[model samples]
Target: METEDEAVQLPFVGSFDRRDGADALADKIIRTLSFDLQDFRRGQRPGAPKGFAYLRERVEAAGIFVLLIGNLGSHHSALNVELFRGFALADPVAPFVVINDQDSDTAWSFTLLHELAHIFLGQTGVSGSKAGTPVEIFCNDVAGRVLLPAAELARQYDLRDAPQAEVISRIAAIAANRQVSNSMVAYKLFREGLISHEMWAAVTSLYRQQWLQNRNAARVKENDRGPSYYVVRRHRLGDRLLKLSRRMLTEGALSPSKAAAILGVKPSNVYALTETAA
Candidate 1:
């Protein structure tokens, strides 16, 4: 809520008021952002999609905060990983989205866009991948369309009549290239009518199984060394919030304790955190 008071309000540009066409909404959002988000690879020309860094910057520029938080294995130690993919709160003045950073990069990207869809629709909620509510399905469609457009998906990924191994190989490659998960790829194919529900189910289940295996291994490895304290703190607080804290402190508008409170750090740690963030 302090962030809301500090935020510069921006007008909401979404057109999803009781509308069923998620693709249309997604398209409009893309246009509003003035870039093709699917071309996530960094580009040479102006206004080209520049992957995750660029996306987060643009969302933040649009007056929305995008934060990456720890996952079940790291932060929420007792919960199942599959039960919490992301969270979103829609406010006209201070909409923000959070993605569990402990997930794979592919899952991170999908969850980022999924929560952005909820923000676009001006809704508040938490979600898991298997959520089947109408709102969740609609948000998934919007996110899927932005990441995997129908025409391009058809041309690049024709999974019909392929062998199981080949199908898995193709989807995995697509997921890596498109910066989306195998589950997202299968879901898009099913939504586009290129794959049957059975195919989608089998593919998603396999990916989920693989994810669990990977997550367990990652937990053991990541815990051994762990991320830098400064890096983790900087990411959780985000650049925008950190920058603001520093500016307010410099201007004598914010006290040390208040800055620490806002940044979720100790009073002494606040200076170090802000300097490292810079």
Candidate 2:
């Protein structure tokens, strides 16, 4: 990865409203980053999410990407005011990303892509209330397409002959393979006219309910000893930030106090922070 001082420069000076505009911008970004569909898929190993690391590396190369585990009571707790959010700054000097980490992996993935769309579209503001806005809609379109390509969906499931139940089953299978929530698959299928809006609503609601139940169960289990502080923090702060902080500390470019402050921990905890790259 490139050094922070050598991060790539991406300048956004205007806005766009058209879906075509969003698609065009998405294409430009993929080309600029030399990213392909395989890069997204290759990192997605079974039971392991490697894409976030890939995204984090690129963010370190070109911008700041923050994973704020708000509900856990860190400085990011302010984000709990909203159910979820991901923001991209418009200020050129402060170009950065802040994504809520207290969501399901699928939801978080979508939010990340949604914010990336905002960065590409130069759309900067609180994302909570802009749901139906053209910019938001455009970003949603971009995000959905990026995660689950329309062409791939069309080729995988035949809406003409497959029964609705079978189609839903196929959707779930595909979603599992892709490591995204089935809700996303339902949305894509609905958009493709392969499923009814009613079906989409029902399926999305069902998945959300399942996710809630699973989360509650996991929370109960987590209270018993779940992951260590640093392990969880690794995901919240991301590998790029943690590794960079450790490197600076080792090179004498940063003091223990400053490193701890940057990492939101006490100076005494600096050693623990650098002990593992997790």
Best by lDDT: 1
The reply for model 1, stretches above 4 Å from the true place, is 1-7, 13-15, 43-50, 71-79, 156-162, 223-227
List, residue by residue over 1-278, the lDDT tens digit for candidate 1: 36335544445624367375887778866776665654565423222123666666667767777777654335656444477778888877677788766666566656777888887777787888558988888888878877777767767655666666777787777767565678788888778776777878888888878888987887777754665788767766667778767887877888899998876678998888898544
- C-alpha lDDT score of every prediction, in listed order: 0.71, 0.66
lDDT of 2 by residue, 99-212 (tens): 766566666666767776776666676564667677776777777777777778767644545556876687778787564678778877877888777777777777777977
RMSD values for the candidates in order, in angstroms, are 4.0, 4.2
Model 2 clash pairs?
none
Clashes of 1: 0
Residue 99, model 2: Cα distance from true site in angstroms: 2.3
Which portions of model 2 miss their true places by more than 4 Å?
1-9, 12-20, 44-50, 72-82, 91-94, 156-167, 223-225, 247-255, 275-278
